[model samples]
Target: MMTKTKLPNKKLAIPKKKIAPKFRDAFIRFYRYMIFFGGRGGSKSTHIAILLLSRMMTDEYMYLVYCRKWSAHIKDSQFKIFQDCVKMMGWQDEFKFNQSDYSFVCLRNGNRAVAKGLDDNQKTKSIAEPTHIWVEEADQMTFDDFDTLNKALRSLKTQNSFILSFNTFINELHWIRTTIFDKEQQYELSEQFRNMDTYLNHSTYLDNPFINQEEYLQTLLMDNGGNESKIASDRYGLWGQMPNENPWLYAFDKEKHVRVIPFIPSYPIYLSFDFNKNPMTVKMFQMSPQKGLYDSFVHMIDEMEGTVVLREFCERIKAKYPFSPFFVTGDSSGQKKGEVGYESKHDSAYSMIKKHLGLSDKQMNPNGYNLTYENSRILMNQMFYNYPNLYIHPQCKVTINECEIATVDEKSMNVHELKKDRGTYAMDHFDNMRYFFQKYFQEFARSNYHATK
Candidate 1:
């Protein structure tokens, strides 16, 4: 962490800007949990920075623990944002900045505002009973991480509020969405989290009074050519469906493909596997008896290895769909023998899925059509064309993200190749789906051909 300060030993006059009516209520209310979620240029960060600085200046007891997902980001982004705010509010002369501690101290009251990375255990440990905490980029945090911070914040005596600000990603199954945005889940949340008045406020660039309208409109027009999600999220500040940049599975659409559909117990659950020792992925697909197309709804990506992963999948399946039959399919590589021969006779993944799930040869689609990469792409695209037939559930967030977010490599023309622009650990679930698609589509095409003949 690095810090710089400019103090002239005299208090400077603050400027008065026309505050928007929508923000007035938030400024006054003292909610236990305050969430400001929306698209870019929403002034969520700006308003909160103002509020924090105002409290520090007025109250002698005010203390804050401001955090970002990565500690390094604190210095470059939020730190600078606050530094600018301090200047904007004309409080530069009355505050003392400590670069070593990554904190700011009010010269008059001795009040302190600390900045840290949530992932930095050392910095988090230093945050002793902070009354207020603002987690910037809250979407990157996991549920467990949020729970830990929540518990820590509750133990404090002074501050009554904890704030989280983020832009909504396409993954509807994110913990933030499930716990905060979903109306049905609010009851469950209220029961678990007693005495906490949770408030969720959404805003966008359009709602922001300070935003440059002319510049924003020009940017929106540039993005309007094909990037609907960007226009929706950045310009309008809505939680848009997705942004498909150089998409590999180009046919996936939120309107046509994503929905809530019930699973049929009569239909056997088809499992597809992607065998990486670290992040082994398994996807579930079952044909809809009524709709006459496959419904891929479940996705499991585990860090465990070998039979343990298979056992975990089996346990989860049994718990979710107890009576439903389990069928297995996957990459041809799963058929190979493993070095861990001491545990069972069959060391391969397909054998483990069979043994653990109690699936016989009839239940397993071994080899999975053995389609070439080009043939697999063609088959998937063909299935995608029949939009009404194929569907994915909202709960399969990672799978949906992979299918929609995946892009083609410039050189190899391969979808799975990780790029600098697109981060890693994304294509595993999508690859698992490919194995199932190749096998099931071949059978589907064959059956239709026979019926026509």
Candidate 2:
């Protein structure tokens, strides 16, 4: 016969001073849901464990569910974290652990803390009625996992609450906003999280006064790269977007390449046009002849386009830049036989634009008439990064945004199809700008060097 020992019956008594200011409310507040999201070393798990232990001591019928994405992770992670909290609070004797069952039972009360790996369906079926639930490494769990767990909680006959904690380093696709908190999905969210009372808190290492500053600095130095998004997420407790691997304008960095410059009336304004029925696009640029590509700047001051006929767009530009001399460059497609606003196909886009704006043939840069889209993009990206000669006025918000976020398709390996719909056709504005550079200033670096030498 094997001898068995019964666990002692005692209630946990935690010191009031042990609870940090950041988590002081965790001990008292029984919210429907509490979200603690941010960087590492915030003591998010530690504080929640202490709060769960406190509740178990008070509510004899309470069943606390501590869950993770995988069952194997529970023993080494959340299970140990909770055990440490119990020991730290000098309540080791007050709780009895069953390693086989993976649970901690309160000696004084019948309340138990169960470790569940959501990966096992059998474990989910075993949770009869839970009063409190904690999901650790929540980013690892899918939206479906959350929904299923929520439905299970409703089956319980008690007023239960949930706690979700995660590090903000997951893909934007799996982000919490896309699933639960989207304003567009408010009806579904409200129905699911009834009375949807939610408390959100973001914490960082700096929020923990006991954090080692030296260790943080060392870690930052080791991980420092061009990955600004990762640093923002890991250090500042912010929602960060990863850099697009196939960004259309891979060279355009707003911090390094963007600048604000006033349009000078004395300099001749260079114009590039792209014609489409819904929305025509145009960009105004001016180049510096005296400075080398590395030292010079290409100032793009204005943009003008609308859905009206070519005649109306031409009239708008002529009226806007009345005094400035316009030098134009555009796609050869503009010169093709098409009835833009005339009786016959012979009356092309160029003929109408030239006639309406009063632009002479000599004023146009014909070099871009046969320029390939691929070649133009190459020149544009090169100038934007290596030469570093481009600048745009703060007034051109649409152009700036299109240049930054436009992406190429991974399968086709081309940039013509941007990821999001380029509504209002603003992405064409960037193409027009690229054409203007290739037409006029693409060879400035080599020419200037030869002239100086």
Candidate 3:
């Protein structure tokens, strides 16, 4: 007892440094893959950047790399995080910044960080397997493109991690949902980040403490009262598509399917046509002169290929309707010259129409056109919602699907949004449908619709 007389009392010390909560916690979270998802300005990039630097601060020879899609893009947007956090954390001049390439690191510790973007396949093919991978704006790249990048991460044999941060304008229809959101699925991320084992850590801009606490900042100030969904999708990390964003889009709901048109009218017949070489599209509408609108109940659709075959489909539709007062409304697109390097698809189609079939001549009317792309977008997007008489034929699924997904690239699609014929055939039919409506509307005011005595 005498020998055990108290050893000199020793004081216990605690860590004076404070964890930022997001990065500090993510560092300990056990998951093979960690996803930080939320609305805009949610501090996702900052959190991950801090975490990567923290790992570097602790150890030597740490393989730390950050990337987006292109090498040029990364050094600017993603590289800034490394530069800022290193300085903030007091890693001073210890790190090297290469202005000419996509690699850098702190000299004091053997930790290195690289930043780059995946703008093309060759760039992706050149990357070495990363110990950790960060993909920003993952939604911008196609599933196939991102999948290609994943190959580089496989080189990490021990303690490797993949971190994803993004704001999605696209929704559950994407592959990410199936891979990560589904309940029964298992992820490699679970080994390191414990939270990954439970469920996805879905965060939003509001959840981020960095945002200004006041209610009147940024998105809160946006004035889109009637278009709240659009605001949410665009500004708040929600999807751009509303429940019925496109009125022409048909619901698969069996409950809404009425075999018979609830209201039929004795009115003048009208026609709307959209033409395509692959699958032609045509729509028919009934005019209501009293209301200055078309009747939704009377319509038709035809989508078939080949001149003789499509012509037959067109004739068959006309015969079924059996109204000589029918009108054709339609549109055309400029196609790129192929191996022949001559006139485009629009030219070929115009030549075919003028040479063989005597279709309506008035296509782009000078009086009705808009002066700018912005104005044209407003006009085109407004059409589906404003027409009270516009209704989908219960059977015309193709046209309905077309109207829902047919997007116009306001800027040219040559670079970031390239697809020679992606999401196109549907558009052809839609163009035909719109053209037919315009044709009928041009002369409909004086037709039998207003002849009642």
Candidate 4:
């Protein structure tokens, strides 16, 4: 809309950068969606006004609106910073604040902006299409909410844009990821935030050199140039999770491996088996990414032996999934030849289990299971962060609990992705997870770049 592809990058060298007003101008001039996330005490609001003012000056009295979920929260411009930006920019007579009624600059060009709320999001289209929209604490709102109201601001032409500003917090499971994180899926994602970063060059309280170091920031990182994560999530406009999140912990995150009891035969089934000693276990992972699957939970009993023999496990799995693909992976611990006891039980488990269960050699191969512990971590992280449809049956209660509580190796501090470090006692249950993940990741890795659903 500004006829410019790139607004000039902000003055990175400037210290004590309190020019939020200047930053706002930059955001509106550059792109359609701008998000400003700054550290505590950063002049976030100051930047908003300046950017809004920039739109007004360039678009010439474009219809603008000052928004807040609650009307009472709007603060006074009783300070010089606000007074200076408003008066210095020659908008001295543009604002009218009487008791609770607040309205500013209702002009077509150099005009006024109405006071509005999310309750009336769709109702915000009386004037020309909005050139820009600003959202604070966008994390609190849903994707559906943004869509319902924000899109109504689209102008008849192209000057329309939206701005999002918020302090960092939990809620990383955001809907914006489809739009901001991956641009190609704009059709599936809301278009409101499609180009947010182009306009938002990231903001932090420290970026405002106007903040006095001695009086504001000092020995502590908050007062000084420290606290990297907070700074990144808040100022850099990155989506982040808070420390208090339960999923953030490595040890308590796994779902206990419990087998589902009330098995429902609704969809085609697949069994990815990983046999183990003592536990003598097999898991039935349901493949339903698009369509919801049964509540296939798992149970990891402390007990080793059970009537549910390896043969029965296989037969039951086959009975459930009949004629569908049932992929299997093993330790191959027994497959190795020339051991001290070459014919030992450890070596024969794979063949014995498969033979008893009637699995064909083609159905059980080492194709996708040839990865190490480190490989598992990378694969899991990808699945968790990138894939949304992965699930275990609710009956796999033990599996889910175990997975949620599963911990990475102590030294490596991950599921098994070791760089230079290594740890003892390889994760037993975690190792078993390879079967399902292998099938999923292998399929994903081969055609992911060209994937379409």
Candidate 5:
């Protein structure tokens, strides 16, 4: 005969100070759906574990069904998290663990917590009267898997909740962004979902209180191998760019490089052009001095595109910035007469720009010859890493879109050639940007070259 140990009747006290402030409110409140997402080292999983354990201690009817994409992953992830939480809370004796099934039962109130894999639908469905469901790495689950688990929360008496936690690794077209969030490109809570008992919380490694004590985590987050998408999604917790197989501007991260840039009247404006009959494009830029890390910052203020002649495009620029001083640079081919349009057969594209913008030969800085595509790609990507102060104005949507989607031909002998199959003006704006860098910032662009011994 064995004597049963008496369970403590006192309520467990959760240390609020240990919890990141961004997650503390959600720990105490009840919402039908709670989403906690961000970059690594945010302590999101640890907070969820403590919240579930605390609720189990308090609510006598608590039944949690914790799940991931596969059942085999539960033992190492969610199960270990709960086990660590129990030890951290010093509640080891209050719970009975079933190691074989990855579950535990609270000895005090008969509450239970079980781990299931979304891969095993029947096992997840068999969890009767689940009061709460937690889907870790929710980005891995499809809509059907989410629906199945959502419908499993059938307890009529208990206030049911569904929790989702993940890094912002998915693209804009993903169901989580399109269906759940109102705006595809923003990080704010959706007003439509907020009214429907949904709670959203975002955090980054900077939010972790323990980050100061962990130097390795800080170094890893800081050094992302110059991957702009990783820097955006991992360091800043922003929506990642759509993955491209052979991106032309591989280091272009909209999160790091796009922002609201105001025009400075004191700085002379630079216009870079890419001339085409169907749709001519021009990018406007301004340079400002900086104190640290970088000597100067390049601000792409605006972009213009239209199916018009060189004269018409110049008129549009003059109308926009009537009094501002302008410098011109673009395609070396623009130097050839009779190529622009019927309106200016005698004047080359550069000459037409000079005539319309009232610029001198000193201001006209077109390269004598265009840099090879291979050289341009190498130099531009090098600048993106070495000079981190480059930025594009949010209003320059065309430029931003081109930077994100433009791809190169990896199979071609000259792999730097842009993939022309995307569309007629697929890489027009990208070319305009390249021309600006190669002509105006030639010194920085040539820094990557090494002389042969």
Candidate 6:
């Protein structure tokens, strides 16, 4: 009856020395907006988890919201990280985890941490005022999504903070880059953001004390199979190169290929189309066929999207280039009967294009077929490298953006095909360009055919 009863260890000890030096200060202090972005093995997630757990354990009113792009991703990611941190700190008995909704509560205090996904708007909106919000894989969310989340941290009683942790795989044009990193560098902020305090810290695998012990990670980071972009992003925590690591048009150089190419009204306008409903795309080019293949110039003067109706799109093109004669080429799927939304159910897309634009069958690419994806990739890359005269107008932003970001399927056994699952309009504009090139300059499809000759 007098036997001493053991009490659970309530002490929380975060291995401060074990934490990366660059991120140690983040655990002790608070910033309105804290950004921890870098390469793999940085311990960014570990630090954030520890910080949130510590805050929740100490403060009764502390409420932390952990978010990712998808709800399904939270269990394996942030939720796991928190569980590991709790176990490592020997605080397992002090907290209770709810598996159903991916939440946990500090038994010592009323503080709680819940996981939410940005994709589930209803769940995200249902969350009451949270003292802290952490967005893991922050780059997956657009600026609007981030802004909405940031605005939701409206608790006045506690010191509210927002944390963003992500890898450096995003390109220069990404919202995280343009808004946070770039503006931070330039010391520029709008009136709305001037009141907020922001802190940014970058850490790579080298910054991790235990990185050497993780032999697999070390090898993976060191030997990236000649993918310089991946090495730069995953090892060094540098901004990724535009167009991604395995860009479909690897040979494209924006400075060399994109320029102010004026419209040649005298030359027949070559129009290329891709008929995805949401963002039906078109690219307009004019060619000087009199010049030799290498010397001849094909200037893409304009690009348009979002006019889904074929008649409306044709009218816009006519209004823009009223006097120029036009030639047409597009996705062979346009040849199929009953391609929706672009035209009436009775007429095919090509027939509608011919009718609206008043084009003869001779002016259109008579071939009612599209080049294979592999073939298109090869020919487009070849054109970018060897066809020096091929240029996209500086104003053709959609085409330029596609050329810069469209990537090949690096994971597949056949790596030549373009990756198309990114979004509905992911590669629509790029496909239009490829279709036009393959049909209009069929000779370029031959691997042996030199553009210069």
Task: Give lDDT tens digits, candidate 3, residues 165-241.
Answer: 77644544344544555433332233324443422444455656655735533544464465766567545666444
The residue-by-residue lDDT of candidate 6 on 276-366, one tens digit each, is 8756889998988753365688788898887457898889989999999988888888888776564467888888889999988887773
Tell me the TM-score of model 3: 0.52
Q: What tens-digit string does per-residue lDDT give for candidate 4 at 6-122?
A: 433332121223354436356523566666654555667676776565455455335665555543454443122334566655556544333444555523344555555544435
Cα lDDT, model 2, residue 36: 82
**Using Cα atoms with residue i matched to residue i, what is each candidate's TM-score against the true structure?**
0.63, 0.49, 0.52, 0.45, 0.52, 0.64
TM-score of model 6 relative to the true fold?
Answer: 0.64
126-239, model 1: which lDDT tens digit per residue?
A: 567777889998877666567667776754445456899987544554556666664465323433233456666677777677878778778766866867776777776666
Return the TM-score for candidate 1, rounded to 2 decimals. Answer: 0.63
Per-residue C-alpha lDDT of model 5 across residues 123-241, encoded as one tens digit per residue: 76677889999999988776667777888876886778899998887756455776677784477666766676777888888788866736745675567776778778877778885
lDDT of 1 at 78: 72
- Residue 234 in candidate 2 has what lDDT? 73
lDDT of 4 at 405: 43
lDDT: which candidate is best? 5
Instruction: Between candidates 2 and 4, name the one with more favorable lDDT.
Output: 2
- Model 2 Cα displacement at 187 (Å)? 20
How far off is residue 287 in model 3, in Å?
A: 22
Ranking by lDDT: 5, 6, 2, 1, 3, 4
Number of clashes found in candidate 5? 0
lDDT of 3: 0.49
TM for candidate 4 is 0.45
Candidate 2, which ten residues in sequence have the lowest lDDT sum? 1-10
Winner of 4 and 6 under lDDT: 6
Error of 1 at 245 (Å): 1.0
What are the clashing pairs of model 5? none
